[model samples]
Target: MVLSLMNKDKFLHVVKVSMESSPYFQLVSSSDAYRAVPPGASAPVRIRFTPSKNRDYCHELVCLTARERIVVPIRAIGARAVLNFPAQLDFSKCPVKVSTQQTLLVRNVGARAARYQLRTQSPFSVVPATGALGAGDTVQVTVAFHPLASGAHCGSLAVCCSSGEERIHTKLQGEAVDVIVGLSTNSMEFDRTFTTMSSHRTLFIENKSNITAHFQWKAFAAEKEENEEKRRQCLLRPPKEVPQENFPEEKETEKVKGFCGDHSALLSSMDQEKMAKVKLMNQGAIDAPFTCLPSATNLGLLFKFAPEEGIIAAGGSQAVQISFRATVLGSFEEELQFSVAGSPRPAILTIKGSVTAPSLHFDLAELDFGDISFGFPYTQRCRLTSSSAVPLTFQLRMSDDGTQPAVDSVDQIRRDSDPAWSKGIHLHVEPREFTINPSGGTILPQGHQDIEVTLCSNTVMEFYRRLLVDLEGIGKGVAALIITARYQPLPGLPQALPCPGCAGCSCQGEVLLNALMLCQLDTRTAVLGQQPVVKSTFAPSPARSWALF
Candidate 1:
């Protein structure tokens, strides 16, 4: 606050101003103080008051001059500004997917200016929600209601002050009513799809009215009436063509009055006896005249729509994707409802498709390498064919046994190698017991893949491995090959099976067995921990001939 001081006398004079020192009162124009107050000219002193609390303040202002000392009193008033906001607001019965707004009057009742902010949740919003109002000033706030569904929505509006840490909440209530919407297509027809595969179609939802439209695809309830009027609710219409009204007033059949001219007492007696007989017939068990045919099952599991619930803006369109997937093989025909909030009834969508098994197979079920020589490598080839309409990705792995799932045991002794000397190799001795070239690959429709499988053994063991064929994308796994191979120690490497890097032995033509790695019967046999010796000049005694006699 600035106060003007004047030197009323017509003489050159100096004036100094000071105020009582306190936390709430401070001098703003210190340079102007203790200055020469020219004759007939005025001087101003500025003072600032910062209120620490809501209370009144008083201070003394002192002025010094050459003639006399003048004293003045100052007071700081703390009048808090108040904004009045309503306790509750209601946007009654608004159209669904449409926005309805109302204006509100907010007044500042105090002698000071106030700034406030307003906030709320979805379906309920405030426009120009934040503002500053002068003392006794009133501002208009528009509260809009945009609901997505047909129901009552409740929320709270908060008004917070910029100066003080105080907030006021106003309870908000709104209701949404229904409206008519249009669609590009009402029924969907999916093509024939493979089992465990999907076929997709798209339909457009048109919100042609002024309001936005929210929709959901709700499945029909079980045990519904089979009336023709009810069935007509779910239908397809051309663009801008409105659907038939669902609740049409049925024509009531007028009752016919029975006033026959010829009436006999004896005939009336016979009719009463017939009525008694009909009551006796109802007392006994009655069989149904017709058979209960099987109704179509709910297709929600196999038929689906992407973005099952969403909102379309006013005068806008949304493309909804429809997908059909089945796990079993059969033809399917089912119907469900496409319900828009505030719509009289849901639009019926018919989905029809068939699912069959995709044909994929191997030429040979089992790959058997019989009597494989030890310390040697053997290789074989097989073919995989695909007659499916769509391409398939496949991966090969050795099963734990002949049962379903298994682990890959390579770089040890079992299963096929992760690909011979394939990836991330370390210091390894043997090149696995089994290995397959191009272990994993893709096959196009009506295509075939030729696989090369190699077996290189360094130990004496029999393998009864089960090769598992895993189909990617569509996971229909089948235990493929029953791989049977054996490797055992021999007296010498056969001429047919040649070993190139041997120190003492050479298969130039054939190698003769001069020594045998044999054990004495009395000492030890082919036990786990026993070792045999090479008896080069061995001649057995004839004790076995007497035992045979």
Candidate 2:
């Protein structure tokens, strides 16, 4: 019971409160609970009554102020049934059209018997919808979930009593899922690729269900399985045809199992030519600079798929690329598996390719800068291509003498000025001169790198040198670019004007054009006044010094 205490006096006053109580009654607030009240102001106080048995209970609340005293009565007639129930219910992740159930513990925790009526909407139902319980009685109420559609859904379950006069509500929600997914194809084949080169192919994922699905790419097959397959193939092939070192056997008899007496004689005459070119390179040899650098790599790490994990929407598709790259020389094959939610089994994909040494070459084997003009730069555009499927890591070096490795002798060469744009070798002699832009770098598989080769000379002399591309991981072969040019002073113009008519007059572009033509083409003029060459004459070009740009 609660009542307000008002200060009837025209001034401020303090109100004091006291409760005459029983075991079933309580003072909701401490005595002196409502102390200060301004003139014409009021404050509230409360008294509580609780019954331990089905019997009547009463309590008195006394309020005292500076002006008056009052008494407030608090009462509890009887105890009715109070319930104990779960705060909320959840039916986590159930398949559509399927039923999932959870129990709701309903108990009568008060003094009297009670009957509960369960009510909720479709896709959710409660068992023993109406049940009576004695005082302190407990029942296990079954709540079933029937998902009508995919995705998250919500509803409410009502526990009603006394014609809904007293009721309790619990939340209802669940995740409805229907997953169906697959791949466009079950197998893949890669192109023949060179070692250290990357070759890739694309496959698609198809989601056929109404709900979104998650997918993952994995390599499920073990190396032991691959060895078993190799071993089986070894037994089927004849000893002479099989690569003996590639597949080892547990028993020695397996190596010569099917080899008859005459077949053993065939093995004795081993092919000496097969191992003929296994000699180490000699640095002193003239062609030593053309040799490629060697490389090593792990085989297990050779194959990989891009965009490792992702989601696929309902009735949607995604494309994924699988790539292969190797550091060793031989044939290689690897297996990959694709697994997704709702699929009974993972999809198997095979990746197989051959890895050979890198084969890199320029479009042209040589660059000829015919006639060089002093103080002017002659430039040539060159394209370096990787024919094999592997990358080409290289070093571009300029050679004074075409027979030696120039990259290692960089410290021995001296230069007063270095071209800041030149990446590798920068030093050049008075006339054996050439510089490369982006002197050293890498090239992608089946890709090309564009570079500019600039040749310049200050002295009048002939120049002969080579530009070497030392490719990494190449067992043997040459990537050499030969350069040849001769520096010549511009030919002097005739002292007398070729056109006699312009001798005493101001010189025009025609006179200069004719003089240039006479000096370059060695043409003798025969009174061709103000007439240009029948065929167009070009200026000195970077490609050919005699032909102009």
Candidate 3:
């Protein structure tokens, strides 16, 4: 008997079926338990009935859900013969041009013997066309599957009883797979200088099969003993998780209950279920359905895919851009593995490259003082190295002119110089403000020099200056080392005071002079009064005094 179950709720509903206190009726085959049934959709539940005695049978089929439980009634006569067979046949995965076989057991569980005939469609044939089975007897029917193409193939098998009973039908399914993929190139090589800029290469991937194909590309260094040990150590470490403090207070309270409190325990269990479901959904979103390999991380190479990941239609192509930047100066080799869906082995693409050090190079492109206070001094240092085999002399000067020349221009100047700029050498920078010590220097092959630049400001404004360095023998227009600095205002300064002098003044005249004489009664008094003493002191000095008023 077939039971059609329909969902009426808006949200997803999970259904399960069971037989309640009915020994004669049993669940044979049905939709999976805990299966999600969408709203307004139906799922089939198949049940079988068998009787031990000759009489009418009655039973109840129980359907359980999260919202409610449904009871379905079962009624069948005990005296009838029933043919039992599997609901479907699955050949699973079969390689192209390969034949696979499966068996189905047919049984007669009834009061009398029965005659049955088996019929199947193309791509599938049964071993026995007709068979007879006594009561409580069984027969095995073998089905052969031979696929010619790559894809899912489907057919059906039907069984008929001579007693004019319901015809039993079972679905047949099998999948044939032969994946083919092509790449435009098998290897790539790059010669890059050690710089912040990255070198890029494009790989063309084409799908050759009729079915859509999925591909994943990864870059990894060649396997080494030390690298393997590091990988092992990385895997040994436990995964990091959100701290307990990040959890909600309610969740913490629930955790504290320890599943002892009835309400809190129920809620905690429900929350755990929801969290598990959410985690599963998130994982499904991140990982492709067919991918079985663990995701790789920290392979050292960076890559950008036009379409990070998606289905490539048959005869379609995709572009994958892989970029590499070497942090150190040396020759390095790496591998890029392309994993195609259903393929056991990955396609390995070789990548080999070398990074050469510049002949004359600076440790950094620019030095930044960030922010400096007024009247305060700030100093920074840069290392310049001559990596060539010959002695090189470099001259440093300020780009006093407002116009700053390009580094390429400095390089051109060096190239156009009398000695061809000493081979693989260039000048850079134009300084407008600030002071650089040891403006010029000479260094032996593979020698290093440190240049110190200091900046001091007295005004309350942004200060910018560039220091240019050039080769000693090269012309002035050649490259110059460019150093930059900026100054900020400092705090605390005396305010301006108002002037006491008149704004306009023109006074240049002297007043008439008057002389005064004083007569002293005593010599000590005369001395104390700051008067010039004369010998043989006389007391009549009143007539000798003259006054001008």
Q: Could you tell me every candidate's TM-score relative to the true structure?
A: 0.32, 0.26, 0.20
Where does the lowest 10-residue lDDT sum fall in candidate 2? 261-270
Off by over 4 Å in 1: 1-319, 325-331, 400-431, 473-477, 486-549
For model 2, what is the error of residue 420's alpha carbon versus the real structure, in angstroms, after optimal superposition? 23
Give the total clashing residue pairs for model 3. Answer: 15
Q: Point to the candidate with the largest lDDT.
A: 2
- For 1-549, candidate 1 gives per-residue lDDT tens digits of 888888776567888787767788778866326878878988878888888886568887888875457887887666766788789888888887788988988899876777889899998999887888898999999988989789999999998877555688989998887776767987889999999999999888877666666677636423344423344432221122222343233311100010001110111110011110100000001111111112256445544455565544322234445545455556655555444433344434444545555677789978888776543467888888887665667898765422221112222222123332122222223225577777889888799999887765443457787666787645645437778886544434232232454855523321222222231111111211242211111112111000000
Give residue 497's lDDT in candidate 3 (0 to 100). 19
lDDT pick, better of 1 and 3: 1
Better of 2 and 3 by TM-score: 2
lDDT of 2 by residue, 266-296 (tens): 0001110111111111111011111111113
Q: Assess the local accuracy of residue 172 in candidate 3 as a C-alpha lDDT between 0 and 100.
A: 95
In candidate 3, what are the lDDT values of residues 1-549, reduced to their tens digit?
A: 788889875567778877754567767764335657888998888787777877667788788886468888777754555788778889998766566888777778877766888898867788888888888988888999878678999998898877546688989999987656778898888878578877878889877776565656544423455444433443343323335567665443322111000000001110011110101011111112111122253433332222334433222233343444334555555544444443344323334545543357777777777775433356888887876544557776655432232222212322233332222222233212355687778868789889887654322334444555565433343334555554432123112112233654311111111111121111111121343321111112221111101
Best by TM-score: 1
Clashing pairs in 2: 197-390, 293-473, 539-548, 540-548, 541-547, 541-548
- Model 3, stretches more than 4 Å misplaced? 1-78, 179-549
